[model samples]
Target: MNKGNEMAGPEKEILDGIATRSVYALGANAASTRYCFRVLRRFLGEGDVLELGPAEGLMTGLLQSTGRRITCVEGAEAFCLSLSARFPEVEVVQALFEEYRPDRQFGTIVMGHVLEHVEDPVAILKLAKGWLAPGGKLFAAVPNARSLHRQAGVIMGVLEAENALNDMDRRHGHRRVFDPESFRQAFLGAGLSIDFFGGYFLKPVSSGQIEANWSDAMLDAFMVLGERYPDIAGEIYVLASRPAP
Candidate 1:
């Protein structure tokens, strides 16, 4: 998000533009934008919602009609501006999530594709745990390192392992890749429990490959396989909640 720097120059503009373009790309990201909502549907509760790293607000915009007040903490200034302009009702805080202190806790916190980019995932997660009201849920999602495409890469010897960071991931600002165990460890160590955990999108190839070669109907079918084999899906999701008190 914002290349870990202040928003300025052509680089930030280019990066900010990616989200807008990606909305039209109908690739993995657009797919994620759609699928993540389904993941949220299983756990989203009534009351205020806090969203972290809502770059350009694809999901944020979607959440608006729920009639729940949405507050967003974004790392990119351009993103904050876009989100504000696109959805004026949302409270957009233009700061890194770790730095922004919440005035109050939320009934639901949705963090999507953010942990993989942050420096200290557990610290952020620990922060997430602190920000939840009792019985509230945290809807979190991340890319799966051991996705079927990566599995194929491993068998082809192009990838050393499932956890191997490919050029595309590095370019997209992914600091680490996660299989289910590693992903679960981060949340568990942060002192949270996942009430439900599963995968969403079964990506048999890279996003670009899928967009280029597969039909929309076929892609929809692949999503079903994720429910059966989550460990190898393109993205993993969990519905986490605070311990009853």
Candidate 2:
């Protein structure tokens, strides 16, 4: 539920409306999230962790496993309430990223699958940069515009272009799809240095297509395959830090 600060009235309602729906818990999506955590785990920072748009706490649950004092900031009240009840140890704050004013910096900040949903990805990244403790890292992942599935969609005439949003994108309230170049530029634009940039989940088709036809073994295999071909991976990630003074 990442949104611009200018969002108001109907726009706010629209985002909240999308939040009430259970999308991430689905079969393929759930598997993707697990794989996302596997990639995130390698670069997770020590001490406190700040997670943005945790949704149903799938990633929140994973972050808690590290025992790093988790705090989640989600804009949707329904999600905030659900997260609080589900993870009593977690501190869930219900507020938009633009309005959230944390009193202290954090060791790690995660924005898994969040940038594409926001109205201003660069602005959000800049905001996150300001909240990082010295040497802390910001980890963000977004759907790749050049993913095999997306490229296939364009070739199959299901999408207008590689960067075009599909049915799932609209349903999930995604504003844009990011390719490798644009994804890297967002971090650079935020004045952060790239510590690591790679991707995971080498999805060859749509989530629906995979869920209907693929086996768990096949799914697991592709999850790791993306590391070798990150440019076209289903999801890409960047680990960034503040430049040296």
Candidate 3:
């Protein structure tokens, strides 16, 4: 799942101990986690990558597997320790995104599910763009307010609308939900042009509910369904790069 969904889990067992709630995290984990990386693999260059809010490193570890130099800026102290311990090579910087200032530019910057957590999305996005080398890639992913299941909920008379926030979203600390238009506005303001955009991982239900009941095969099919109906996908992503000089 996308970072906005706050889907969580690290490859190691250590993450399980620190998670505040296992069920919610499992649901978050189900969002665009793998598919985003897989799509990004096609566009990432051979430059250093900076990851904002690595969280439980569910996606962070996968980013590491790409075999590129990655620097993670995470606000959580315990998580920083965990990341440092697990991937020694990764330069894990412990700072809120607003306070972080790296010495050099990077080739790629990943903001997976990060904007919804921040107070000022455009500001942070501008800062991310500022750290980019020319032609650097900017990968942004967020939870889709108009995801497949959310719409279903609306049609079923369960949810008020796609934008309506639920208890899980509140618990996850999400400040806002995004549709493509709002998501695109942030990038346009930050001076990053959208090179590619789409949704992934169609969710017919919530993560915890699905995890408790669905099989692995069913989950895999959900991802395929997302590709087919991105407008209703669980999470939406945009792959962008710095504008031409």
Candidate 4:
């Protein structure tokens, strides 16, 4: 993935740099979806996979190697074009997730940390639910608003001036932030049964670096400890099943 730094494009080059830096600075996002594969592999079998918001085909390409037919739907024209060029073996669809209509169903769908940016998570989940075959699984991850560090930071801010840039930034365009309960409720309303829900990391991140930032040592420490004690994780990953008849 570090090779992403060598890829070229004006905006994409910059974003790719950030993505690459994020990997080195924060223990590599490969860790982000590692558990998803760990959990999904048990139930996915030799089934089809659908991935939403595949910006640069990083994870899409990863899923393709599992020997399952993979469909990657992305709204960005440049990204979709680049993905098609880079991974000709995988099927890439160009469209917003909200508008995409698959001609077939899938046994497993993995959506990582994409809901908070959606205008209607429930609608999207329901759409995903419709795409799944009976007994299919939906794997979703989201940021946890009630993270331990966030609460502590709030209290600390009460005593003195805090950095304005450090605030929970909704302006750059995330529609909603979710706590565990609220997130679970949305999934349930979409007709998926929650199989598991837990946090993944517990480090403090200022808003500026929310996308990526950390010392290499701290990143390693967080990865080891968070896997051991997932309860204090700052983000949540849930594996939910479509209700069985």
Candidate 5:
């Protein structure tokens, strides 16, 4: 059995609490996967799309509906198998994104929370450049280690570290974290140009579904504040394009 697929005691406990206290939040975790896809559809008209690190295929279903040829590359065997079973029409490649490459070029490349975990972000971006056709876009998302929640948690002694959103000592720890400027530089060095980038969801992960009723108002306030001070947003979404000229 793949060890990563198995939930550890702490993770199981958290999931149990989430399921009991708020199924909506449990569901929202998967639902949030769609937000990036909406942004992708606007850019990718009618061509192939590449999705790296498609964990458990949460976003695969949404991409399938776009009518574009979708290729999902997953590192974990369990997730690849699950994704293949769910979307037979969609091509699922059971390989690490670092090793796998499609035969054809793509109009769009999508990845979420996959960058910081990789050993070499720049190398991966460079590799992805080959798969993109001219003017195609690469979309990526990751947690902001400098977010308000992380900062407050550090000061209040609620959390231990601020550099990485997740615990790195754990087997599943993220390898690196990025501020907007650093993140942009990584792509720039890879020959990709930034087309769009922004931070979002300026809230703590612990807040959960309890905020659902008032989240809109709360997020509005936080977003305004984050606009003035982006270090507070919990996560970021970025779009980089392969230069046409």
Candidate 6:
């Protein structure tokens, strides 16, 4: 079903521009997306899945492998077109998360790397929570502000603050970075009960540095090592569900 809506004017252009950027295609980001999917697999419930902001369909490809009915809500027309062409099996809806209203609830709602870009994360989470069927789980992940690399940036005087957006963050259209505490508060603010909170990919350096120097084995090892130290991991995630009635 090609139920796609068009977004007009500057906002649409902005989104389409971001969609064409090569940031998500980076070696580190691609690897991280795979690792994030591995973490998400354990928490996925049975039935349909809803994925928000599946830019370039990196995680979308992984989600499709589960043989579950998958629907993706993406704002960028470019991404929507690419995703639809790349995975014709997936139903891609081109609407801002603020405007999307699905007819059915989902067993799993994923907001992978979405919070940092949104103008209102708690509001988005609240919407996702509302769209969850009973026993459904909402899985969300975002870059960690306190990750070793960010912290190192601060100490190196490259970043004015750990939470401050860097050049890469701006390039990626990230509005804010969340440390563990702030990240948890977003879920709680949305009235979601966290089922699992953890992190992955213990990056000791920037993505550029990693791509230039790190081997595949080292990348894989660090991806596993992030679990032991969630506080300083490159990315953090939560598996959450609505509070019982």
* Among all candidates shown, the one with the greatest lDDT: 6
Deviating ranges (above 4 Å) for candidate 4: 1-43, 158-172, 206-218, 227-231
Candidates 4 and 6 compared: the better one by lDDT is 6
Error of 4 at 124 (Å): 0.8
Model 1 / residue 233 / CA error / Å:
1.2
RMSD of each: 3.7, 2.6, 6.3, 7.0, 6.3, 1.3
Best-to-worst lDDT order = 6, 2, 1, 3, 5, 4
Q: Per TM-score, what order, best first?
A: 6, 2, 1, 3, 5, 4
List candidate 1 segments past 4 Å from native: 1-26
By TM-score, who's the top model here? 6
TM-score per prediction, in order, is 0.89, 0.95, 0.86, 0.75, 0.77, 0.97
**Model 3 spans > 4 angstroms off:** 1-31
Candidate 2, residue 74: the lDDT equals 83
How well is each residue in 1-245 modelled by candidate 1, as lDDT tens digits? 22233444553454454444434224668777776787687688877999998876778877887889999987666677778888888888866666677889999999988888777889999999999987889988998988999999999999999998897776666679988998888888898987888997888888878878988788877887787889888889877877665
**What CA RMSD would candidate 2 show?**
2.6
How would you encode candidate 3's per-residue C-alpha lDDT over 1-245 as one tens digit per residue? 11122322331233333234423224547445766777677778878999997877777788889898989987656677877888888998866676777889999999888887677898999999899888788888888988877888889998888888777667666778898789888889888888988878888887778878978778878877887887778888888877887
Listed per model in order, the count of residue pairs whose N, CA or C atoms clash below 3 Å is 0, 0, 9, 2, 1, 0
**What value of lDDT does candidate 1 attain over all alpha carbons?**
0.80
Off by over 4 Å in 2: 1-8
Clashes of 5: 1
Of models 2 and 5, which has the larger lDDT? 2
Clashing pairs in 3: 1-31, 1-32, 1-33, 2-32, 3-113, 4-113, 7-28, 7-29, 148-232
State how far residue 79 of model 6 sits from its true place (Å).
0.6
lDDT of 6 by residue, 1-245 (tens): 34545555666666777887747856999999999999999888898999999998999999999999999998887788889999999999998887888999999999888999888999999999999999999999999999999999999999999999999888888899999999999999999999989999999999999999999999999999999999999999999999999
Query: lDDT, candidate 2, residue 126?
Result: 96
